[model samples]
Target: MAETELVCANRECRIAQGGRCIEGHDDLAKCLYYGNEPEEGDQNEADDDQEVIAPFNGVYLPDAHPLDSRRADRVLASLPSRMIGVIGVHDSGKTSVIAGLFDLFQMGPVANIIFAGSSTLHGLEIICHDARAASERDEPHSERTKRGEVRFYHFDVLRDGLLQSLLIADRSGEEYEEVADLAANATTMFELRRADVITVLVDGRRLASSRDRADVMGAIPLIIQGMAENGAFSRKPNLAIVLTKDDAVQASTRKDQVQRDFLAIIDGIRDAFASHFGEIGSFVTSASPKDANVVRGAGLAEMLEFWMKPGAEAQGIRQHSYSGRVFDSLMIEEAKRG
Candidate 1:
């Protein structure tokens, strides 16, 4: 390299070497230091002004994802966690319920429980996107869980100052329904065997139609029966028969009759599976509602509280109300306000 003195004061200018301003100025007169002498500064000061880049010491990690079946056990081994398994037929709003709870935490404390933290923020955000105005969709919807792509979302919450870890499993409803055909189908769904709370969703929209009501009401028992035959319940976990899409049912003409049918179905499930479950409960929830009359995330408080604390004698459908916790609860007042 030939040693050449700079023609301008600006250290960045390469006019002497390239016959043009390195700063890309169109006119020579326009250059700030075009006709000025370069400053004689301390070598240290020149070194300090130069950009210094550090070496690439660390590798980039991928975005956080929901826990897989293999990883679920590892998390459970490290932390004292509770596993929640949500089961339903296709389009039963199973995924929406999980997404709604995550949405509630974004506001503040739900049912008064603090929004502590989540392991799968990306997964939750993906499910929640379509329901928000940012998605640019006219009607809100939940992204359906793909078959065989089961994942478990984790939430670490403070319950009365005690950090309670929760692992909520998500999978396609079609997969769960497969267990009804053969008990062996549940072998792939090992989460069910270890679940502390098993929530079976009843689609309120299906219940609204007389044609679909009977079949919809009958589906839950078959799921339970097959799982039971598979020895899915080694220990009796608390059972929550959640009536999802309450807003849809609210907007229907058969609202009253649907509610009646829901109760009857609950009673039947209780009597049939009472021996297999620790505490049998029924809850009504509308995660994201189309009807203005029905509140978003309605009745999730009771459902969550019930899941947290077992041995509740839940005989009927839980109303959309939040009762404070003497023990741990979801203090859902803030979430319900929306």
Candidate 2:
């Protein structure tokens, strides 16, 4: 038969130029569509034979899961836990501090606290990924943590051969601000209430600057007042007022000047919340230290020792804890010296 005169047996085939199928099969016998046309009974059979693929059943993985309160509760149910909650305003260095604490225990033993393991290794990797990358590139900026999410970084530490579970809450500065502003009613507030130790991070670089000191100092009282209003201080959680970015402050000014600045901020916190709580411990910390290429958690170990174990070197004058009356009197004495 001539090419044009020839017709495909399959009704689904569109005859192109010649006797070829649209799929480029020229021979009628070789064409996939040739005898594949569905008839009345064939349609039902084909439909019945078709296998349906199920949705993925193995597992779903994320870069990191935000340790919300529910996940924290579940995690705590599995272990004997001590909760350390970090509080700060936006860019006040709460995440960096938590990452530093992780690095400290992960790298090696500190003050006889051996690095055992962690349940949320992926979560730690996500939080520290940028800072690790930045260190390699010699970049000035570290990663900013996710805002408004309260994440828990888990750690198993062996202190003097005794294993203990440590849960540190990494919350954004905005979350703290919300509570400070009396706006937060979410799970974060409850997390704060449950915290065994609450550390308030004050940006050292900002507090060191004359122009920023007033605003920074002014915000401290409001946050303390807000926490007090929300009953965070009702149980009198162990308070640590951590001055972060100490490296930046030291690089820009004299050591004595930085000490004065540190004292002022601590005094401000003391004045604001002293009567509400029994004792407060203040420390200067640098997550990214000057001599280290990576985060060494330089000042974190001391802070941890002070809160976790009572009689480490943190019991000295630098990490001293005092009652409300004693702290107020010290503040008065320091004010007279200035």
Candidate 3:
């Protein structure tokens, strides 16, 4: 089949083609005058070139279901479902965690897990540090910078015959007050709404600090609770409270007390979450584990597997909850069902 192309030329009307606008006409007076009208033959040549050179307009590629396609049915049939959502918090190490997971999933034997690495979820990113910009107007505009809003990155892990992906959304660091304002007033709501799950990253070491504790703890829960009350959380998405910068927490401890400190910090976070939001699992994540710490280095993969497991919500609460093969777990469940 021969492909047809279209173009438009009216400046006011974005859709234009062949020196004429999609409206089928344009005012020559408003257009830049070339002093004289071109010959009909020349105009025709230009139109032909535009038709040849311009990309096809008003046509979007159609969506096709892989499972429904005859050629891909078998592979698609074996593919498992996906669970995805954005992880939140300014210091939450959201990007670092996602990046680490991408590396692990790509290199590991797990084929069922997939990572869709992208930053354009509905075309939004935390572009500016909103609070800083608002607070320091006296600072030179050049000195002020904005962190882009979070984008969605996809991670899929397929192993033991199950295929699922986690779509991670991230945002820039800003004060909770600003996030609340934006959440309440912004026209773009999907960024805050599109999540099958939401992992609120908490700064573990700072949880007890008086300087910024309230901003870190209170802001996040308030926003989440408000969302729940407003029906946004009706899906009752599984919430994962991640304690970011585990390395920092570990580094601050005495050599002999490292394990105790780690456990205590995690316990504090878990307790606080239970007190405030009623029991969410807390995972300690170290993006940059110290050399010689192989056990800690593997934390990312371990956490990913735990969080993405099929029945994690039910099973996560009761167990020591580490070192499970998600793909193997899924296979066992499916085999039993059959």
Candidate 4:
């Protein structure tokens, strides 16, 4: 490391002589362009740490698909990681939030967090495609999580100068509503049982409507009670009551009223369930909002930071052993009878 070394090995960045960074960074060393150029015979060394996306022999890597619980275990076994489980009703903006976080990384750092890499790059890109201008859609739309079993999207990020692994579980919101309908259904949500953070989303658009608001808000208590009875919070993970589609609420004429209602729900949940969780918090996010007035990814960075918090430490390895779908119809029948 000599003063003569160019930023990121770029010849034009004569930083030793005070040439500015190509990316306008004050310190050339912090610039993306500022790194050692791959030295001769260095490709093999770099591949060794390639987020396990490296191929078996340069052409046999695992498909970049969402990780199942088993696959997720293999990754967790190798790296220190945090698991976040997102639960909500239909169209609650789960996929949009996940896709928005991915889109933010494409532009550059988010909240000063560096995107190191992802194990499910293709899967992440697929969810984000329709929302991008590249899709040639007149209006952007998020791809909803397909109704099925739970799957995880893995991201390796460098935050606060340290590399950390994040595993965010994605499941159809309809499926989560089923758990709200029957507490016993929660037993099948192994992801939540294993989660370090469990985020509950309420649709901000619904919050803006007087008629629809009650149904939407009422579901929160039912979902939490169901999960609690099923032992989903046995480990006491951090609980987050997240309001999605803040843009919708902002556009409503009763914006102030809606915001207050949302805050009231957060406070009520805290008072009611403080003992059931390790920590309880709330967040507002407007990920991939269609309203032009709303900053496209507003509040997502803060939401991501919350997920990255050292909340309820991760529990021991997950013990779910489902063959196909984790949903157990027999358990639901029993719960109904009881």
Candidate 5:
């Protein structure tokens, strides 16, 4: 103090005079900088940035639905029969949903279908084979890698007393785009084209995703439009727009935001067809395996239930759709006619 020492400007410098460092740290020469705060305008710009929307509010029903006497009697009397094709974009859980339905059907929880393998009655034993993708290169037929692998299995049933088994033909996700022509033919000219019902399982997350929505919607229009225009889905076949992965849709408090997002997507798809088809039933479901998370599994089932027969009702068999029942009845009529 007596010598009037000048402290170095560097915060860590111990030098008593000017800008020189007394600590002998060679890096002091590069420390001539001050931290500056962001300008106020930049903060304002950040406020306008887009925000990610939250998921939708999904419904979950309890197990073991109570039966409706009148409805059950009526449905059984008519006994819905038809080749119901379930389809959707890749990773849409079409196979999972079918598996779950099979589980339910075997348990006799859903409708009582005439199961094959028993020597009691006569009905079709449906085969569910996942067609693999055909290889591009010169690979042996055995070596030809399955482009798309089927996900579900085939079941046999005799439709003597109830609606027999369903032959679940699983086409791999890889084939979704490539098989549009096949799907179209399936809906239009194939034997199942005359199906009494058609269940299209759509992936909720994919449909909700802003990225994939457009392309997916684009791929489906031709098939659906062709189906409707060619009198395939026009039988007023009780159409079930089964939504897979409902848990993802409802795992948040941001349903308003998510619904708007999905609504836009669905509307876009609807617009693509341009009033070509009527409003089909909508359902959300989660068909992940036992180990799969509950949210995903339950969510998918919920979505599917919303638009389908039993799930569409008030959370039970009592609340099934008469339209769905009617659809089943029509299919049975078609089968009987055949």
Candidate 6:
């Protein structure tokens, strides 16, 4: 029998039993001490396979910049457009109403309007962050929206296979408050002037609170008066008076009184600016019914439905009109009364 040859126990040793190591001392090209090393290409492919792909569902602002006007124009050109303006005071649930509308569309289509896309997904996300975080943490907290940043959320309205575009502008409540207090014109005021529909948000919680009631009720007429003085309501947009935080009001023992007070405020608006508004409708919404601390969206469908319908079709719900001469007479009468 031939002499027994000793084989190296190192699995990485490339040399045959009798072959010269190429690693200087033997025929193998490398040393077995470092173990087997994969080829560069193989390693790269392995890394590629392990890489994670992120979800790209919605479009966001570029570096927190506003949406491009050219892009907006291009979108508007192809489809019939409707512009909705949301107006309210600070902590009056403007953002919550917007967040609720966004949430409603995202879940599925709203009546005939389907979710086509949004240029302000990140903006919506920011507004709804608290509600989402609360749900995740099993805790409740209010969502605070940033001020001075007015963004537009775009949607594709689908009806009978025809697609139309709807753009809703979410303005900062503080901005409206400034205009109301100073009686000055701002960029948001211009948007309001051109909007096809306007949703005026009133915080029901504040309405129910005796401490905040006066200021809350006082602010509504001021905002409307400011807008009217600045010609923001010149085009006579359809109006939806949205009462937010409805759940809070309903739960309170003083619900009847709060409702009465809110109705009185609405009647005052009708008397003051009836001719400047077309097809006015009142809506009560609770954006966050499940968590009292954070506002989500509830009773938004009816509000959206009111917004989506045409002025002529919605005439039955009209609480006001756009009578130019009558409005002038009313303003004159109010001035004399003052």
lDDT of 3 by residue, 53-160 (tens): 566678785332111123222322344533344445554555556545554544654324454432222121222211123535442111111354333443345555
Encode model 5's per-residue lDDT on 1-338: one tens digit a residue.
Answer: 38743434334444543545545655754434212234556566666555556777888743222112332233234434233455565667765665455444444433334344321111111211121123232311111113433322334444335544333334544454444565444432332243334566656666566676566556665556645655554344445566566655566454455566555546655566534333455555665432234622343333323323321111113333455555655433223324
Clashes of each: 6, 0, 35, 3, 35, 11
lDDT of each: 0.82, 0.69, 0.45, 0.83, 0.45, 0.72
| Residue 118 Cα positional deviation in candidate 3, in Å, after optimal superposition | 9.0
Candidate 6 lDDT at 116 equals 74
Q: Which candidate would rank higher by TM-score, 2 or 4? A: 4
lDDT tens per residue, model 6, 145-230: 46755567676767667767777776667888887777765434545865779888898998999899999899989988888887
lDDT of 4: 0.83
lDDT of 2 by residue, 86-166 (tens): 778888887778777777776677766787777788877666766665546564344666675567887877777677777
CA deviation > 4 Å runs, candidate 5: 1-80, 105-108, 111-163, 173-176, 179-192, 229-236, 251-257, 264-279, 289-338
Overlapping backbone residue pairs in candidate 1 total 6
- Sort by lDDT, best first: 4, 1, 6, 2, 3, 5
Q: Give one digit per residue, the lDDT tens place, for model 1 in 276-318.
A: 8897888999998875456778888788888777442423345
Angstrom error at residue 81, model 2? 1.4
Give stretches of model 2 more than 4 Å off. Answer: 1-66, 133-135, 183-188, 290-295, 310-338
On residues 1-338, what C-alpha lDDT tens digit does candidate 4 reach at each position?
Answer: 66564535554456556666766788655676576684545566656756566456656678998999999988777777888999888888889889989988889988787899889999999989988889998766987778878899999989877887889999988788887778888898879988889999889999899899998878888888888888888778888888999888888997898888888888888888887788787888988888766777787888787787787543456355556775732352224322
